[model samples]
Target: MVASIHPSLFDRMVKLRRDLHRHPELSREEHRTTDRLVSELERLGLECQRPLDTGLVAEIPGASDAPTVAIRADIDALPIHEETGLPYASDVPGVMHACGHDAHAAMLVGAAELLMSRPEPPPAPIRLIFQPAEELGIGARSMIEAGVLDGVGAIFGGHVDRHYPTGTVVAVSGPVNASTDGFRISISGQQGHAARPHETVDAVVAGSLIVMAVQTIVSREIDPTHPSVVSIGRFEAGTASNVIAGTAVLSGTIRAQEPAVRAHLHRSISRICESVGQLHEADIQLEIEEGTPPLVNQGPMVEVARRAASEALGPERVRTMVRGANMGGEDFSWYLQEVPGCYVRLGARLADSAGYPAHSSRFQIDEAVLPAGAAWLAEVAVQGGRELATGMVDDLEAAGRAS
Candidate 1:
């Protein structure tokens, strides 16, 4: 099925992807990247809307809003510098396409082209959502606020997965990615001379104790069956040697798949911080900032995506996730909250050697997966659009009889 994609179109995608990789942009700053996408999408004679400062919404007319099925692709880079040494490496110093968002946007455009060239439109319109700020964990919500989901019935999206080999796609039915939320602990106490140990309430000691206590939240407070994480990524205390610091701070993130586990982690962290502070005679303040929710694919939408993968690349190539649910967070969950949709991982691993993971300076994907990703996305749009249109018609009929 991949071979059926015109060689010229595939080559165009490869070249354009390299161009994007050459000059990458960070979250919410994808102006150049946005311009390039707008040009290509307009050339295909599709309607375009710049719903956000960067990124766009390209619409391909079909049966006139019969039931708009959406396909989303993120288009933001990372802060890491390029280390892959490819000829098309990042041109901007200290910035790179470390997460394969470049490839994502490229393949999405390829899908748009393939759909545009069809002899006739599908049973419904298709909305191509080129979103920015995905790395900030807010792009999906930003687009939704801009009315991207207006009149939309179903949506489909995917990410490049290095764990699986190229030519394969993993479509999971539920709980694919975990929720991400962050917390900060501030400790305040007395400061005094180093010699006056009893005179000072050492915040450093209190902060250290708090960090250790935070670890027990996942291990003891939460159920062992439900996987959760409490990681203190940053800790600050003490100003200089031989000084009892009066203030300290600890910051970290929380990851959990289930709602109960997520809430439990938050509660346990607060309890641990307060208890530790009281034990050490220090004032403790805790703040938790909510981020994206866990991505749980609906069963019916998963079937649509899985069948699309099978039809696009053959039934043998389509597969389910081999590992358990991942702890990583994706804002795509925000879209699923608004409407039913399916999210899959597009395999891009080239060899057994474990290459640099996403967000690494050396991160990269197998370019060969470009066309495969495109084909899968295009197929899902066609299949999902038809289903949504039929359902919409059925609903209208039921309403008419009642009226």
Candidate 2:
């Protein structure tokens, strides 16, 4: 059941992907990207709506007003200098589509083209979400607040994965990605000369102790079976070697697959900070900022996505994540919190090069995945729409029987 896309369409998508790669935009600043997407989508006669400042939503009309099936693609780049040195490398310094968002956006546009080329309206409406600020993990929430999901019953989205071959698709049920939250700890202590260190409470020593103690939260406190991480990415203190530092600051991220583990991580960190502060007789403060939640794919939605993948690309091409669940964070999880959805990893691994991870400067994708990804997105929308419409019929019949 491998659907064939026109060669010309694939060529156009490749061109579009290259164009976007050359002019990569950072989060919340995708005005030009938004304009380009609008132009291409409108060319297909789809109505576009600006639900936010940077990102926009486009809709393909259907035969009936059944709940819309949404397909999402993030349209933001990372703050990395391009080193691929391709002719179409990013023109903007310190900003590149190292995460393959350029590919995601172009594939979505390709999907729109395929859907619009169909002879008849689909079984239900389809919404294409070109989201912004995904790297900061705030785009989905903003779009949701702007009512993008008003009529959307089920959503489907995917990221390009370099770990698998280009022809494969990973659609698995259960937690696929971890929740990402940030924390900051500040310590204030008395300062004194090195010769009189006894009179001063050393903030550097206290902060170091706190950092080491926090590691035990994952290793000792939380269940080892449950994957969790507490990493201190930044630690700052002291001005001169001779003086006992009076202040220190620690900042890092917390990640966990389960909500219970996430909460436990926060509590344990706060406790460690307080205990260390009291022991050192210093003022220590801990601040936790919440980010995206864990992305757990619903079983029914996963089935829909798998069916779509099997139909669009052969069943042999469909696969699950060979490595276990990913600890990385994705903002698409926010949508699943409100509606049923599946977030998949589309294989875009390069055959020649040992692939670089998503946030690396040297990362590249197999361009062949563009058409396959577009096909999957299109088929998933159709499959999801049919499933949702059938469920609606089942509900109506059940209600009629009850009456």
Candidate 3:
């Protein structure tokens, strides 16, 4: 099933995304981006609110006072230099929509246009949320604090993944994305000359041992079939080659599909750091910063998204992802925690390039997927709202009869 939105509206969506790409903003600094979105959403005659300085919400009322269903698009860009070299490439230095948020924002606006164009308004309320700071992983939380999900029964979101073929859409039923947690380890040892290394406990050596042991948490401690990753991305120690540094810092991230696995990994990481320091007779300090939890798609919500996908794109284009829960985290998980929702991956693989992952300077998306993404979201909101309202009415009536 292909989307039946007007061609002119589709063209407008493409142009809007391109314009956003050229003038990308970063994280909480999305003033101009929010301005453009507010203008478009207001033009569609929806009620708009800019609760966060950079994020905004727009509502489209339906036929009744049914619960709201929210559809979100992250508006923030990344601090990456553009190498795609397109004419509409980012004009701002060190700022670009390398993660396809430009596309997400524009598509949601397109969805707003389509939903408003209906001859008769939707059956239940719909909210279009333009969130900022997704790159920093705080936008969704900020919006939630601002009550974007108030009175809403369900939510829907998507990310552009270049790994999938253009026009392909994927949404998994269980844990579709991993929980992201970060840790920092500091080891303090006696400073001494490199020539007399035996005199110093060698904090660098201790930190290295901790990093190596942390890897065993995923390989041995966790089930082999369960998805998990412990990567030591940063290690810093001596300033000069001749002297052993007094302290070393090691920082990395933990990713896992299950909450139990995440907890186990964190516990093991702490144990490894402390054990390594004891063995080397060095003082150790561990700091772990908790991040978003794994996004587990509610079974019913995934079914709704799957149906919407088949309706907006052809059934053949709607794929069920069986493997590869993205280790990257999304704050959208915050919304899912409050209500049932589904987050999908909209394929943005360019026609010419093989496969370039997001956050890379060369990241690009196939422009053709814009309408499909937008239409799918708008349709899902309308349909999902109706389902939720019907369920609520049925339960209320049952209660009244029992009374």
Candidate 4:
């Protein structure tokens, strides 16, 4: 029978999660939170190194010299004001851990505690990555730039989802999330009086036309089989009622799962905006800010995660996802871009906490999943270490070639 996680580790995880939820900080600004994590990891006797502006890497040496396995937890919170009525709600106004990074951080720390308690180290070294600025989608990249994965063989992480019960975990092989990119359009025209229709190029009208035309790019230009999203979420124009605004700005985002689709979306958005500007006789300016890439999990690594989750919880509580890629993007994708890795979703919902989404001030996760998450991470480390030691990646590649 699989051993149950210690009771003390479960209690510690709950307390740490609550404390982090209460004193949340924003992206790239997690000073106090970083300090607390450093202390906890050090107490567990892991070799620690702080590389990024507000992040740290803790190394747990194993019994052998196999490739290192890294597990990441984002520590940054969001800018939302707290609305949750819990007694341990965010003490800092205008800042909240509504996205559940606090829970991730606490869970990884609990995993460190459990792993450190074994009589000897496991087969391979374990890297505990406390990443900052994940909400801005740069933490993983920053960590990579700092050589966090210099010798790492694989990585794993999990996000909290309210769609499932607290004991459940959802994961799958291949692309799980989409690439997110942002765009801004500036339309310039001649300002004129509202009553004088023919004298000047009204930017408000031109911008409206451009907005309506932009929608056709997705509906008309792209292939129907490939999923894509282009949302003009924000628009700005005239201030006074009598005068037509000289300029208008439109800002939105693009999301796609495949690289070819992502490139097509970016190219099409620019082409559509420029075409609309020429058609409306307005000077158009376009800017695209690229975000994270799609997270594609390696098939073998995904099986390891599935087994770990099933070992910690019951088999019924662990599932392989069947749905297509999610539009939401993650910085963890940065790590996957360079190495073979798999990221999972841990359910944090209780029966009473339905209808609330992440990043809202009212967001709260079921704390009962704390032990389950920690136990799964520990199991993944154990299994992944063994796989790396046995040359799993090479064997899998050879089998793919033979098949």
Clashing pairs in 3: none
Lowest-lDDT window of 10 residues in candidate 4?
1-10
Ranked by TM-score from best down, the candidates are 2, 1, 3, 4
Question: Of the candidates shown, which would achieve the greatest lDDT relative to the real structure?
Answer: 2
Model 1, 123-235: lDDT tens digits are 78999999999999999999999999998989999999898878788998878899999989999999988899799999999998888888778887888877789899999
Candidates 2 and 4, the one with greater lDDT: 2
User: Model 1 scores what on Cα lDDT?
Assistant: 0.89
Return the candidate ranking by lDDT, descending: 2, 1, 3, 4
TM-score of structure candidate 4: 0.92
lDDT value, residue 295 of candidate 2: 89
**Which is the better candidate, 2 or 4, if ranked by TM-score?**
2
Model 3 C-alpha lDDT versus the unseen true structure = 0.87
Pairs that clash in candidate 1 = none
What is the clash count of model 1? Answer: 0
All candidates: TM-score: 0.96, 0.97, 0.95, 0.92
The model with the greatest TM-score is 2
Off by over 4 Å in 4: 1-3, 223-225, 322-325, 392-403
Q: What tens digits encode model 4's per-residue C-alpha lDDT throughout 1-403?
A: 1227777777788899999999999999999999999888888877678997798999889777778999889999999999989999999999999899999999899889988997888788899999999989998999999999988988888988777777678878877788888989898988888899677677888778767877877798889877778888999999789998889998999888778888988888788777777877889899999999877787688988888888778799897664576779888999998888789988777677677788888988888777777888887887788778778567778899999
> Which residue runs of candidate 1 sit more than 4 Å off their true CA positions?
1-3, 400-403
